[model samples]
Target: MTLRACGLIIFRKLHEVSAAAVGDNIEYLLLQTSYGTHHWTPPKGHVDPGEDDLQTALRETQEEAGLDASQFTILEGFKKELNYTVKGKPKTVIYWLAKMKDNSAEIRLSSEHQAFRWLALNEACKLAGYKDMQTTFREAQQFLCSQA
Candidate 1:
């Protein structure tokens, strides 16, 4: 059976693209798993018993990235789902678009992850390390651009 997971694609707006001023520019938040493969991705994990997908997304985002739905605005009409195999087992991930209102929102990590990054589109795709995840990043960028 395929595993199901859900998460948020959190981003902030930036003035310029300098590495030193990333926080000042819009960046996407991706976390590096402390577990197998040390893969970097948006805050996501297996869904829990009887939980709705959005609730699961919110919960995982909080647990993995320390941001709650209340702290960010979840853009309406935008959600991305990715399907792929991890360890040769079918897996599916659902991602919702969100923007951290404060931009400087503090992030607290759980044991599931050892590191985190706020990356631009290209950088994020490279760190994602999975074809399915890379496509998700592209779709997300298109969705955000359409909103403007």
Candidate 2:
């Protein structure tokens, strides 16, 4: 059986910049997992039974990051699917792009993640580590840039 997961690529626009220059102001949220290789990623978790993909994304974001749905605005047009294998089993992860409603909103990480950071596009890609994750961030940055 395949393992499935979903998450939001949460970002905030820095208040120091103008709304018209969203590209310069955008910072992506990344969480550093407490376990394993201590890999960094966006808030994500396995899909619970009876939960749809989008629901799983929102729930996991709230549970892992302490940011509820009201804290951010989901971007309707951008979504990404990543396929890979874990322990010899295939896994799929879906991610939606979202912009934080308030740039000053504090991040509260659960025990699953030891730390979190808000970084610009290039720095986010470097910390994300995995090739697929890097690609995801790049695409997300591009999407936000286009919106500007």
Indicate which candidate wins on lDDT.
Answer: 2
Candidate 2 Cα outliers beyond 4 Å, as residue runs: 16-21
Model 1 residue 25 lDDT? Answer: 51
lDDT of 1 at 31: 93
Inter-residue clash pairs, candidate 2: none
lDDT of 2 by residue, 27-109 (tens): 89999999999999999889999999999999999999999999999998999999999999999999999989888888889
Q: For each candidate in the order shown, give its overall lDDT on alpha carbons.
A: 0.85, 0.92
Candidate 2 — worst ten consecutive residues by lDDT sum?
15-24
Per-prediction TM-score? 0.88, 0.95
lDDT of 2: 0.92
- Indicate the worst ten consecutive residues by lDDT in candidate 1: 16-25
Report lDDT (Cα) of residue 71, candidate 1.
Answer: 92
Q: Could you give candidate 1's per-residue lDDT for residues 1-148 as a string of tens digits?
A: 9999988988887653555544335579999999888989898878999998999999999898888888999889988888878789998888898988887789999999999988988899999988878888888787766555
